[model samples]
Target: MRLYAIGDIHGQLDKLLEAHDRIQTEAGHDAVIAHVGDLIDRGPDSRGVVEHLMRGRDAGRNWIVVRGNHDRFLPAFLERPDWIDPGLSSGQHWIDHPGLGAAQTLASYGVDPGLDREALLREVRRAVPPDHARFLATLPLWHLHPLALVVHAGIRPGVGLLDQAEQDLVWIRQGFLDSDADFGPLVVHGHTALDSAAHHGNRLNLDGGAGYGRPLCAAVIEPRGAHLLTGKGRVPLVPEMTG
Candidate 1:
């Protein structure tokens, strides 16, 4: 079967649909698609994007969606847990650090990160149905294979993949990936998008903030192999914010 992996969708429903069509055409038949998460809360059509994914999964579309930091926020919101939505305002989840980076990002963009949690709840509810929430909840933290371990961000160096906490798996960036160390497993991640997939000895970051209009891209990886797929440019990024 053709095993295909795409990077974070970030609610770019049109680009996602385009990417799917392109993948289908390239494969010349149906194939498995493993998504690296961050499916909602940015761009437009967050609801539509997730619903499409649910339909695909329900139809036995051999898919794996590893949980992303953005995806992680919903449960906390749903359960009224301690953590707040860190990835707000900038329109990117993992990048919007609630403690430090979020403030700077909002100031830079002249927007308020303090959009009420209650309002956010209502927006999410309007966009996402119960089935979609269940779908998001059901996603795995990582997809491990002998060849590669796919994660929304990346696993912490020296940490066992299975033992990795959700936050580290979804939100961690440079400190985790830039470790002058190896993670033992070749980690394929999509959280910290770069201009191109950064190829360390074992870490592959396949997100360049495509939802930001840079380019919704992914790296197709196999043992002794890798390639980039730039999906159709339907994902609109506020030009100012990207700068």
Candidate 2:
């Protein structure tokens, strides 16, 4: 069976749909699709993206969505808008940082971002479908396969897979990005953006800056190796360093 791993979607439903179509056309019948998450925030149509995935899953499509740092912030903000913390506080961090698309997401859900926090939260709760919330709540942080370890962000180096901290798995960068240690499996992840996908000998990054107005990417992994599914066709993954 082929394994198609998609990068951080960041609410770009159009790109997500395009990537899905490419994957469906390229992957074998028994393929499984894994999304290295960030499914919401930082783009137009966050609600649409979540709804699309939920529908696909309900239709029996094999999909695995790993949690991301942005994703982690979502539940907290949704559950308790009054709780003020970095990333989840006052919705300002979201506006200033990667959550620039937060307003857009709210708009998609038919919630007015201009409303006061309490009222906005209430509107969100009323507008966002229950299934979408459940889907977000159930996202896994990692998916391990015989040949691949799929994650939203790179994993901490020198730590056993089972012992790695959840935060590092979804939020780490420098340490994990700099490490060259064998990680037991090909670490397929997305968090850091790049002009293109980065394929180190030990791991592969597929971010491709979809949140920053670039195309979302997907890697099709088979027993033999992996290839990037593209509009042109399947492009073989080659080793390269990003920094």
Candidate 3:
């Protein structure tokens, strides 16, 4: 069974579908497609993206969806409009923060984020479907495969997978990125976007910053190695080639 990991989608539904088409063509319909989360925000069609994935799951497609920090924004804010994640984009509200892209997310649901706080929250609550809210709120932080661990962001160094904090699983950076520690299975994540996929030996980052107008990336992972699934076909993904 081949495992393909897709990077942060950030509401890029077209790219997500295109990647799915390529995966089906290259690896067959039975291949497992692991979404590295951040499926919403920063793009034009958050609602469509969520609906498409939901429908796919309903049809029993081989898909794995993990939670990303941006995935938490709408649900958290809908619960408490004043909520702010105390991470990198601390202080600013989720919708107001350029990096978070909640405005675009709300817009996808036909809600105007420019409305007053109370009105905005009310409009969003009315716009978003109950199932969509439930889907975002209930997403897991990680999915452990025999060959690799899929997560929205890299795990914390020096901590066991069971002991990793939820925030670190979705929003961490500082300690995890620079470390050489091995967590048994390869850590596959997408939070920190790079221009291309990265193979750091111990971990793999597949985010190509689709939110920043770059391409969405996906990698084909084998038991021993991996390759970037491209339009032209597989490209060997190695530390030297990535850097």
Candidate 4:
């Protein structure tokens, strides 16, 4: 089976549609598409991105979406607009960081994050419907296939796939990114943005920094190996050895 794992969308609905088109034209209906989270924020049309995925899932399309750190923020912020987890991002509130891009997300829903706290909460609550809230809230942390593991971020080193911490799965960096430990199967992930999709022997980083005005990318993975589904065509993904 061909598994097409998409990189962080970051609210780029047009790119998401383009990626889907590539998959449909190249791989056809039998292939599975795993959206590697961060579906919203930074770019335009966060709401549209969510609705598009939801529509696909509702139509029984083979789509899997994992949660990203930015994904978690929207639901968290909706519940407590002023909430901030100091442990994550050095106490930066979701809306406070331009990188997190919650303001853009709010803009997608026709709400303003700049309004005073009470009014902001009210406007956001009214703008975001419950179904959308539930959609974001209930997303899985990871999707495991026999040939690959799909996660928003790299997994914790030395931990069993089932034993990885939730935070590490969506927010981890140094320990997982720097390690060269074999993770059994190829770990397909996003979170750390890059110029393009890359492989590091143990894993693949597909995020092309779409939130930063870069193109979104997806990889077609099979038991034998993997290749990125680029605009030009398939580009082979060759994993590099790391320490």
Instruction: Write candidate 3's Cα lDDT for 136-199 as tens digits.
Output: 8898899998789999998988898899999999988888888877678888999999998889
> Positional deviation of 129 in candidate 2, in angstroms?
2.1
TM-score (C-alpha) between model 1 and the true structure: 0.75
User: Candidate 2, which segments miss by more than 4 Å at Cα?
Assistant: 84-92, 95-100, 241-243
Give the lDDT of residue 13 in candidate 1: 79
156 Cα displacement, candidate 3 (Å): 1.0
Evaluate model 2: give its lDDT. 0.81
Residue-by-residue lDDT tens digits, candidate 4, 116-158: 7778888998999889988998999999887789999989888
Can you give the lDDT of residue 9 in candidate 3?
A: 94
Model 2 superposed RMSD (Cα): 2.4
Query: Model 4, residue 220: what's the lDDT?
Result: 92
Report lDDT (Cα) of residue 181, candidate 2: 81
Instruction: Assess candidate 2 and give its TM-score to the true structure.
Output: 0.90
Backbone clashes in model 3, listed as residue pairs? none
Q: Which stretches of candidate 1 lie over 4 Å from their true place?
A: 81-127, 230-243
What is residue 183's positional error in candidate 1, in angstroms? Answer: 2.9
Clashing pairs in 4: none
Show pairs that collide, candidate 2.
Answer: none
Q: State how far residue 132 of model 4 sits from its true place (Å).
A: 0.8
